[model samples]
Structures are given as structure tokens and as C-alpha cells.
Target: MTDPARSTVDLFAPDVAAEPYPVYRELRDAGPVVYLEKLGAYALTRYVDVRSALRDWETFGSAEGTAFNPAMNQNVQGVILTAEPPEHGALRSALLERLRLSSVRELAAWIQESADAMVVPLVDKGEFDVVTELARPFPAKIVGELIGLPPELTERFVLGSDAVFAAMGPMNARTEQALGVIADVLTTIGGITAADLAPGSMGEALYRAAERGEIPPEHVVKLLWNYAGPAFDTTIHAISNLIWALARDPAQFDVLREDPDLVPNAVDEGLRYEPTIQIWGRFCRTDVSFDGVVLPGGSRVAVLFGAANRDERHYPEPDRFDVGRNARDHLAFGYGMHRCTGASLAHLEIASVVRALTTRVRGLELGETRRHLNHTVRGFERLEVRLS
Candidate 1:
């Protein structure tokens, strides 16, 4: 039996954040559930436990707040990310009606064309920071255009979106700064009207839904606030992570070159291999037991997505960066009801970039990389690369 006394680990510690995989392996070996006194939550590490917890929203809830700290958990309410059931359904449907796979598929050609155009200039440049030049800017631009915002506003939109992801952690300096950014974003979103967006854009669609009483008028602002993070940050980091993976393993890039059909698989593997978001918070609404570990009602829990993705129980050779692996079931975008609403759109964007990169560049040479530090998400701040 594992020692229950040694279950706790400070997840927010810098060392763990910098390289979480090693710690994840240790946690998984410890047991399915580890009681983390530091964060006042039970940390679920094993793939089955984490996946089950996510789907059992009734037992492990998000309604109270999905952040580690009470302040954020409480303040983050009313947003789709924190809401439950009928409320969540309303908030999500408002946006998904337009962001659905069929609807987003219409943008596939544009996104591919855009990806090709963004990559063409860099192909000849030989060396470039993928984070700044391609991965970072492209998603923000695409999200802005989709939301009907002017291109100039994309930067601010991205900053605000970053804050959304950062605010998911415990109350700390990062959360403090993120609160300020979120406030500003809300103010900007509150002022926007359907007319401000393109004639038939997602932003316009949201407003039109509000007008039709499909969702609350107040929810229009919430919907706008919601799109910034999922639509921009996660997809941005996924693309960067994919590029890093291919560059780190040229054989994988060669695999892509040989069979462009694997671009979708490549995206899935990237998300599974190096998910952008590391951990997410959920609260127990009732006493829940998993693998003999009983979490009392009202207890907070951390779902370690990064760890679950690499769980040996679910994936053999999980650490290997193999694009051919069937990683479609990974928890990177989450699972069940709260699964990312923009999963299809994010996939489209990532696939477009992969397809374009494989067709254009022969290979990539890694340079110095600077990783971004956020309380919740994992990604690059600077990823230097040289194309051959």
C-alpha cells in the first residue's frame, strides 16, 4: 500500500511547473488520488481516475468555481467555464451554434491559405522564432478575424486571453495581475455590439442569439470573454508544441512529409504529448470514492491533464513522440461535458499549420527556446528554429 502520509506535493512550485512530467510519473505511481494539503485538494493522477472524475460532474463539480483558490473560484462563476447543466448548456450552445464542426469547416480553406501565407516568408528566412513569428501571431489574428475584431486589437485580445488561463490557479501575484487584465477585457467586451463584428461572424452570431432570446443578454459579454482563451491561447500553444515536437524529432516531420494524411494524427499527438493546459480544478459536490480513496463532499480536486495524457495504464510508451499513435482520446482538451468547445476549430487551425509546414519546409533545426510561465498553462514564450 502507498503511504497516505506522503501524498502531498506542491503543484505550483516552480520546479514542478518547469518540467512536470517527472513529477507526474511519481504521482501516478503513488496512487490514483493524492491528497495535496498545500492546495487543499485531492490530486487525481491516473488516467482512469481523472477521466472518470471529469465525466462525473455531479460528484466533482465546477459550479462552485474551478480555480484552486476561493477568490478565483467564486469570482469566476457565471462564466461558462464555471457554470453547470442548463446554464452551461445555454452559454455553450450560444457560441457552438456558430463554432460547430460544420460551421468551422467552412473556414478550413481560409485557415489553410492563411497558414500557407504565414509560413511562406519564413521558409526562405531559414531561421525564426516559431512562437513570435508564426505560432503566437497567427492564432490571435485568426481569432480576431473570426470574432469580427480589427487586426490591431488582436494583441490586447491575446494578453487578456493569457490572463484567463493564468487566473485558473491559486491566489497569487499572477492571479492578481490576471484579474486586472480580465477586468479590462470584460469592459472591452461589454461595449461591443453585433454591428462591431463582420456582417456574418461568430461575434455577430452571438449577439443575434441574444436578440432572439436564445441566451441571456448578459451572456453575450460572457460568451465574448469565453472565446478569447480557448480560441487563441490553447490553439497557439498546441501549434507551437507541435512544431517543437517535430523539430525535436525530425523523423516525425519526415513521417508527416511522406504521408500528409497524418497531419490530423500529428495534431492529436501534439496535444496528448504536450498539452497546453497542465491542471484544472473541480470541486466535489458529494462524497466521492475512487479506487478506495474517499473524497468528502465539498473537497477540491485537481485534474492533472498532462499527467493523465501520459498515464502508462492508458498509453504504452506515452513519453515517446510518435505522430502515428492513436492519441485521439487524450484528455488534453478535457473530456465529457466541459470538453473544449473550440476543439474542432483548434484542430482545424493546427492541422492547417501542420499541412502547410510539411508541404513547404523540408525540416526544422532547433535553437534556444524560452518557456512561458503561467500558473495553469504550459507553452513557449520563445521557440527559435531554422527551416531547411
Candidate 2:
């Protein structure tokens, strides 16, 4: 038997965030559950353990703050991200009816336009801050246009998204800052009318669904808030992440350069390699035992997406960055009832830019990278790159 005194959260010490895989491997080998005193919860580290819990909401609840340890964060409530059951189903249906793959397809023209505007300007500069000038601004505009906001609102969406992601942690300084940003974003976004929204994007579609009595118009309040704030951070981070992967290893870059068709595979592999959102939490409604470890009822459990993606049991040679690794089953997007509703739209957007970059740029080099730290979407503050 293992030592009952030593715990596992130490493996997540500040420096450990810089490289979390070793800790994850140790935890997986130790057992399915590890009690983290700092975060005050049990953690599920292995593939089978986590997948089982995530799929069974009756046991692992979301309505009680999916990312906050119930033992720590006492104010957890049911947002669309945390709610389970008939409640989650209704809200999610309202969201997906508007965010369907068909609607995603319809937005292609707008996505193409937004992407083109960002790329064309830097083609000649040869050296530009990819995150600020490209990734940050590009998704900001895409989200703004979709929501039917004035130019000023889009500007806030950029800053507000930064804050919202940062606030998804302990009620620290980041939480305070994110709360202010979220308030401003909600005020700005909630002011939106049918006239303000674009005719065919997800934001506008939600308003339409409301008119049909699918969802009360007031619900559109959080709906649009989610559209701009939550979506932007993840997508922007993904963009910078993909570029980072290529810059780190030219063999991978060369692979994409040689065969543009490999861009999608490369993008998925990049997500698996460096998931910007490292960890998420859920509440356990009942005491459960797995692999001989027991977690008490109402305990919190954090599922480290980045660590789990790198789990050697599910992925062989997990450290290798192959553009053609066939990452079809990757969990970068959470699985089960809460699987990302925007999966299709996100795929199209990432795929489009990857294909475009592969076709156009002969050489892409990074000059400097700035990381914007958030509790959740921790990624680029600014990434400078030169394309030739």
C-alpha cells in the first residue's frame, strides 16, 4: 500500500504548472483518486476514471460550480456550464438550436472575411505581433460581428473575454478583475436588440429562437454573454497555441508545409499537446470508490484536461508532436452531455486559417511571445511572428 500521509497536490506546486505530466503519471499510477488539500478535493487522474465520472452526471454534478472545489468556493451556482439534467438540457437545446453546424456553415462568409482582414494587413509587415494584431483581434471581431454589437462593443468583447477567463478560478485578484469585466460585457451585450445583431449568426439566431418562444428573451442575456466572452478566449488561445507548436518544431512545420491537407490533424494534435485550459472541477453528489480510493459525498474533483490528454495509457509517445497523429478522439473539447456545442464551428474556423497559413506563408518565425495568464484560458498576451 502507498504512504497514507503524503498527498498528490504538491505535484501541482507553482513550478509544476510549467510541466504537469509527471505529476499526472504519478497520480494515475497511484490510484484513480488523489485528495488535493490545497484545492480541497479528490481528483480523478486516469482515462477510465474521469471519463466514467464525466459521463454520469447523476454522481458527478455540474450545477455546483464545475471548476470550483465545493470545499473551497462556497458561492458556486448553476450556470449553463454547471447545471445537469432537464435544466441543462433546456438551456443547451436553446444554445445548440442556434449554434448548429448549419448555422456555423452559414457564418463561413463572415469568418472568411474576418480572417482575411487580419491576414492581409500583416502580409507585408513581415514582422507583427501575432496574438495582439492577429489572434486576439481576429476572434474578437468574429465574436462581435456575430453578436450584432456596435464597433465599441466588439472592443469590449476583446478585453471582457480576457477577464472572464481569468476569473474562472479562486476568488482572488483575477476574480475581482474578471467580475468587473464581466459586468461591463453583460451591460454592453444585454443592450443588444434584433436590429443590433447580424442577420444570421448564433447571437441573432438565439434572438430568433426567443421570438418563437423556444427560450425566454431574458435568457438571451446570458446566452449572448456566453457567446462573446467564453468563445473568444478559447479560440484565441487555440490560434496562438497552433502557431506556437509550429514555431517550437520545424519538422512539424515542414510537415504542414509539405502537405497542406495535414493542417486539421496538426491542429488537433496541438490542442492535445498544450491545452490552454489545464483543469476543470465538478462536484460529487455521492461517495464513490474507484481503484480502491474513496471520495466522500459532496466532495469536489478536478479533471485536468491537459494532463489527461497527455496520459500515456490513451496516447502512445504522448510527447511527440506529429501533424498526422490522428487525434480524432481527443478530449480537448470535453465529452458527454456537455460536449462543446460549438465543436463544428470551432473546427471550421481553425481549419480554415490553418489551411490558409499553410498555403501562403513559406516561413513563420516567432520574435517574442507574451502570455496573458487567466484562471482558465491561460494563453497569449501577445505572440510576435514574422512570415516570409
Candidate 3:
């Protein structure tokens, strides 16, 4: 078979990370599987190929760890993100006790109330920075309360979550710095005991699960890390990006306002249009062929979630931001068993923000924005807006 297409795409470059859709389009156009020369990894840019790889986790194993760098891969071992088979299921089961759809649905009323409490005042203010005022604090509050994290420690965890994703990239200066932050965050988490957590909180529940032998006591901290690290960054970015999308397209916000029932669809479309997670790593366990292109054993494969979500072949008029579009199939939360355990919670949080905005704000006026560049995630660090 002909050699797989190769591209010199520097996905981690500041410029590329700032505005990656054009590069995503280029990667998708390259082929089903393109070799990324700079990273020494193969990229699955097409929706079909990406979905297939994510689904067939046995071939594209997570056991070796999902991050590109060896240190991160080793660091993430045994967590749900890296575990395979029976161990993965057991770990996931414990997590789902609180994160399942029914459980998440039960929290909707409180989530909506929290969103209103945070957003209504911001709306009344007329102008605010979406990142600091709404997006960041909203999730930080919700997740913090749920996890029983002390209010003072919330910001550190949020910063640590960013570091977690940042460290997943190549061992560059950024990754090195992120590693230091992660080490500090881990140390902080290690200090917490069952007594330190709030009664009936998710963090406390994890400790209880360990006590009951549902999961090992040793797994409690790593499981807590799983909950804390992922719960903020992706949802925070999603909320900000969704609002940014609506701000950029008033017509879409209008569409959402006309049909409040479309809030879930709006969230999905927003995730598809600009996935917070741009890429994730998978190690090829053995020689695997995708559309006649062979990925040799022991290869590092980059699963381009952002690219697949925007693949024109999978999403018609992929670039357009339509709140009514049914894009829930998007890879933003990934696919298959390894899909994000907190997806239900994320949807609830994002939908809560949408409901609050559509109810209270007539329109949104976009202002200056800045991108939050990280190795694997894409989002705005500062997003200013005026609500009318």
C-alpha cells in the first residue's frame, strides 16, 4: 500500500493552537491517517478513522497511557484514562455512582439555580469577562461544592487541571512547568483525608467507596484526581466557547431563545464547532491498518477530536455554528467506554448556562477575546462580552 500521508503540522504551536480550525481542515483533507513529523506521531483526522480508533481501544490501547510524552503516560497509569478492561470497568463503575445520567439529572435543579445565581448578576452588569465572571467560577463552584473541596483550594485545582492537560504534550518548557504544578497539586490532594471533605460530597464518597472495598483505598486519591482534573477545564472551556459562539452569531442565540428545548443541541453543536480537547494520544498495541495505511506497532497516534468533529464528511457545513444542529455524535466527549465519565455533568452545566443566558439576556455583544493555549485543550483565557 502507498505510504500514509505525512504533514509537518505543529499542532502545539501558539499560532496553530490559537486558531486551529483551518489547520484541522488541512489535516482532514490530508488523509484518513496522516503522520505528524514534528511530534513523531500519526494523526487520525477523519471522523470515521478517529471514531474507529477510539472505539477499538484494544488495538489503540490506553494502558500504555494516552499522553504523548513518556512521563505523562507513566504519570497517568492506573487512572480510568489509562486503565483497560476489567480494571477500567471497576474504576468507571465507582465513578458512575455519582456521574451517571440519572445522578446528573438529579443535580440539574441545583445546577440551574447555581447558574442563575452566577449569571443573572453578570447579565445585569451589561459587560463582563466571560472567563473570570461566568465560565470559570461557575464550574469551579459547582465542582468544588460537589467534590467537597474547600473554597480556598478551588482555584489551585482549576489551575492544576490546566496543568494536567498541558503536561500531556511533548516535554517542552510548558510541559516541564505544568509537571511542577501537577506535582504540587498531587501533594495537596495527598494531604486531604476523609475528615477534610464535606459530608456526602463526591470526594467523601470516594473515601467511603474505598472503605467498603468497592475500590482499593489507594485508588481513592487517583480517582479523586480523575474527578478534579477533568471536571473543570473541559466544561469551563465548553461553557466559554458556547457563549462565544452565540455572541459571534446572534442569530443562533435567537434560534436558541425561540426554542428553549434546543439548549442541549446547542451545547452539542458548540462542542462540535470548537471542541475543548483538540487531540488525545493512543498507543498502537500492534500493527493496525486504517484504510490500507499501516500504523506500525508501538506507534504514538494522535486522535484529533477537534478535526473529526469538524470533518465535512461527518458534519454538513461543519464550520457553521447552528444551535439547532444535532451534533451530539461529535467526539468532543470522545466515544466508546473511554468517553468522558463526566459528560452528563458537563452537558447539564453547559445547558444550564444556555438556559440562564437565553432567559435573562436578550442578546450578547462580543468584545475582545484571547485564546488559552495548552498542549491538548483549546479555549479562551479572556472573553469579554456585553449582554443586552
Cα lDDT of all candidates, in order?
Answer: 0.86, 0.72, 0.90
Per-candidate count of clashing residue pairs (backbone under 3 Å): 0, 5, 0
Model 2 spans with C-alpha error above 4 angstroms: 1-14, 69-78, 208-214
Clashing pairs in 3: none
- Ranked candidates, highest TM-score first: 3, 1, 2
TM-score of each prediction: 0.96, 0.90, 0.98
Q: Spell out the clash pairs found in candidate 1.
A: none
Which regions in candidate 1 have their CA more than 4 angstroms from the true location? 1-5, 212-214
Residues 261-341 of candidate 3 have per-residue lDDT tens digits of 999999999999989999999998888787787878889999999999989998899999988788989899999879999
Q: Report the number of the highest-TM-score candidate.
A: 3
- Give lDDT: candidate 3, residue 364: 94
Best-fitting candidate, scored by lDDT: 3
Worst 10 residues of 2 by lDDT: 69-78
Residue 198's lDDT within candidate 2 is 70
lDDT of model 2 at position 373: 64
TM-score of 3: 0.98
The C-alpha RMSD of each candidate to the native structure, in angstroms, is 1.7, 2.8, 1.0
